[model samples]
Target: MSRTAHVNRTTGETSVDVHLDLDPDTVTVDVSTGVGFYDHMLHQLGKHGGFGLSVRTEGDLHIDAHHTLEDTAIALGSAFAEALGDKRGVVRFADATVPLDEALSRAVVDLSGRPYCVHDEPLEMADTIGGDYPTSMTRHVLESFAHHARICLHVSVLRASNPGQKPDAHHIVESQFKALARALRAATRREGDEIPSTKGVI
Candidate 1:
């Protein structure tokens, strides 16, 4: 069976489309969120997760990137959940730790049909990275994705160092995304033809 889904969402602030294929033999990513940094991050998610994913968005950038980022995450998460269907045969729980230069992050995931997110990071950067992507929206994106996907996700920046200097913002964020991607990929892997939860469904 093919685990794939497509989602299109439109609101007064943004319009977003996402396509997700979880069982692809090779990873392919195409993302355009109008914010360069955000696009880079989404690409990392798809590439590291070993998924065929695409995302496109049009938003009121004249205002800000908040709506664009948040709505795109919601659409992406919805597409992922739709692809999972009944969650049968899935690994259902996984964790990963990833490092990028001086930043190390960890992500844990459970496909429990309940929405929850715990995001902790000690990143100090300018209000925005790449001039348009707001640093504050990092946690918001994770929260929105987890809620819409109905998954329990926890992400933490466990270590970051620059030889007594503050950590690099880009590395910190990228490591978190990489860890999340790896965890999600493992959690969604097909292991056996059975639901993983004791409740008989997830």
Candidate 2:
């Protein structure tokens, strides 16, 4: 079966489109959301997760990036869930830890057909990155993605502080995204022709 899906979502605040291919012949990532940092993050996610992802979003950015990022994440998650289908032969669960400079983060994922999220970030991290992307939106994006994807996701920033330097929000956030991508790459792998859950479904 071809594992691919496309989603289009439009609201008063934003219009978003996402395409996902889980078993793509070649990885391709294209994202344009008006939020530069977020675009880079999503690129990392698609590239590291071994998936083909394309996203285009337009939002009322004069107000803020909240709607754009949230809606894009929702669309991406929806497409992912659709592409995954019944979860047959899926690896279903995985975890990964990644580090960027002084920052270290970990992500755990379970494609359990249930939505839950636990995200922890460093308190000392900067308030913003790339001038416009609010650091607080990181958790919101993950939560929205997990809910729409019907998956359990846990992301934590294990270390982001240096002895003399303040925490870098960019590094912390990038590490988290990379870790999440690796975990998702593993969790979404096909192992055999059987459902991973004991109930014979996921």
lDDT of 2 by residue, 9-67 (tens): 99999999899999989999999999999999999999999999999999999999999
Off by over 4 Å in 1: none
lDDT score of residue 15 within candidate 2? 96
Clashes of 1: 0
lDDT of 1 at 114: 98
Q: Estimate, for each residue in 9-128, the C-alpha lDDT of model 1 and write its tens digit.
A: 999999998999999987889999899999999999999999999999999999999999999999998998999999999999999999998899999999989999999998566578
**TM of each candidate vs. truth:** 0.98, 0.98
Worst lDDT 10-window in candidate 1: 120-129
Cα shift from native, residue 13, model 2 (Å): 0.8
For each candidate, the alpha-carbon lDDT, in order, equals: 0.94, 0.94
Task: Tell how far residue 176 is off in model 1, in angstroms.
Answer: 0.4
